[model samples]
Target: MKRLKAAVIGCGAIAHNCHLPGFQKNKWCDLIAVADPSTENLKKAHEKFKIEKAYTDPLEMLETERPDAVTVCSPNKYHAEQAIAALNLGCHVLCEKPLCVSMKEANAIKKAADKAGTIFMVAFSNRLYKGNIVAKKALDAGKIGEPFMIRIRFAHEGPSPGWAMSDWFYNPEKAHGGALFDMGIHAIDLAAYYFGKITHINAMVGTLAKKIAMEDNAILQFRFASGKLGYAEVGWTSKQGFAGVEINGSDGALVVDYSDSVQLVTGSTNPSGKRVIRKKVIEKNPTAGGWPIEIDHFVDAIRKNKQPEMGLQAGIDSLRVALGAYDSDKKGKTIVVG
Candidate 1:
């Protein structure tokens, strides 16, 4: 098997912790180069990963190395430009989530991907979780009949004091938005993945604790095309991290406490006219976080010439919801999503 040559465009925390390590772990991938504007980050990544080539300019790296695939882990503002460049260069792209800061950029990236004839996958990692996959299977199997309502919450302490590699997250110009774009995007994508396309959105966004230029917390209500109602709350001001999703249906309920486990509870009426309740707890592998799975899936898509599960269209759809949330908040009313 010919190993795929891979390059990373950013040396930020996500690149360092997930993309880089994921490429290194994949037996079919050869991490040949890395590009970053910061000399410190480039040096650190090169030294840590034992990468042979490091360049300050991503375009130069793309032109020179011409890797088979590239992971765009750059700032939110640069995702579309870098991904489009890589795709135009005939390289498959695994871009980090939220796709881009705006719909125009997202559409441009999608167009580039369509023209390039290469796999373009957005890193919506949550969908790769085994628990989530099982939950999806159960839903599809009609274990939870007619899923009508979904609620998701993702919260953590602000990025500045913790894992963020740079302060760019606080800048609206760089990040586009705060928690709504950062942590909230995962919830938004997962909601769409579980439910369906969001037809309308009502949202409230504000900087409740953090002094950032963008909102640090957000609440979003969604009406899916399937007529399912969805709710999401994301914040960077929580004292501790919390991640969970609950789906309520007419027959039963599915709950995924991402920090712990997934559960399904069902109710039935017995022949004696007594109510019966059954609970099943699913144990998820603690070691699985989906980064490796997503990376492997991207590589497989490239090798097989198949569309990725979370392709460019998924990225655009999720971005539409995120941007819709911002628009709804700005207008102080519900916004119709196309």
Candidate 2:
């Protein structure tokens, strides 16, 4: 396929740092169009990326330009609607995480994708990370045995009015849930990716600090179909940045730590009870890179007429886990995840 035309649906922080620049780096992708309700953001993206078209309304861009593919970078609330619209227009879609605010919307998008015969992918960039990939390889090799248990944690300083000085990140109506929905989905999806299907979950959400309407902190405990137990703790009020996932098995364990390491430790009965023979670690970069590989993969999948590594179902499963967490959080009991 010759250079494919692409459009961006939202001009938010993730779009700026991840999707927009990532696509710009792809030689086979033409960053032709962009859409955002904010005129200022649309203008900046247009000037910076040299995109041919900019619109405050995505429908206008879709109806007028009809690009081959579109990246839905909008908030969780709009992901389903915009993606459904794009798929209905016969365009493949790469939608941002938390596929939709509800399972109904996710299913609708899935149906639309199927009916339109367009590739619909959910962008969970963590799966593209070298560290995560390495972890998967080790697990596949049985380095971590059968994945009997796991613990995942991710936290940040939380989003202000505009963490990047852009806009519209904290509003519940725009963002949907809160920290759990915003950040927890990564861990949720990754666990499913590494171990197995998530069968059930129980969680608690609370607004520990910050005068926000949504929960700034959340704790979730769940079980996967493999009979493996797992827990995830996500928060936006953390003063110290911490992010990592650890998977435990009968014979050994896999740990992905923020200190830049993916270590496989084995032999619980051995002296010292463990050892790290292979260490794969990533240093923190100020710019925080990852999207380049994601965009490259997207382009490759499109050209090859294949599904991206993270497909629509993968995205929907992740969102279901996140929603399950929310349900568990509210109901104060474990909820079964589809």
lDDT of 1 by residue, 220-288 (tens): 999999887999999999986557788888889988878777889888887999988887886565226
Clashing pairs in 2: 203-329, 260-281
Report the error of model 2 at residue 311, Å.
1.1
* Highest lDDT scorer: 1
Off by over 4 Å in 1: 268-277
CA lDDT of each candidate?
0.88, 0.81
What's each prediction's clash count?
0, 2
Q: Highest TM-score: give the candidate number.
A: 1
User: How do the residues 154-247 of candidate 2 rate in per-residue lDDT, one tens digit apiece?
Assistant: 8887877547445446788878888888888888888888877899988899999878888998888878887778888998888775488888
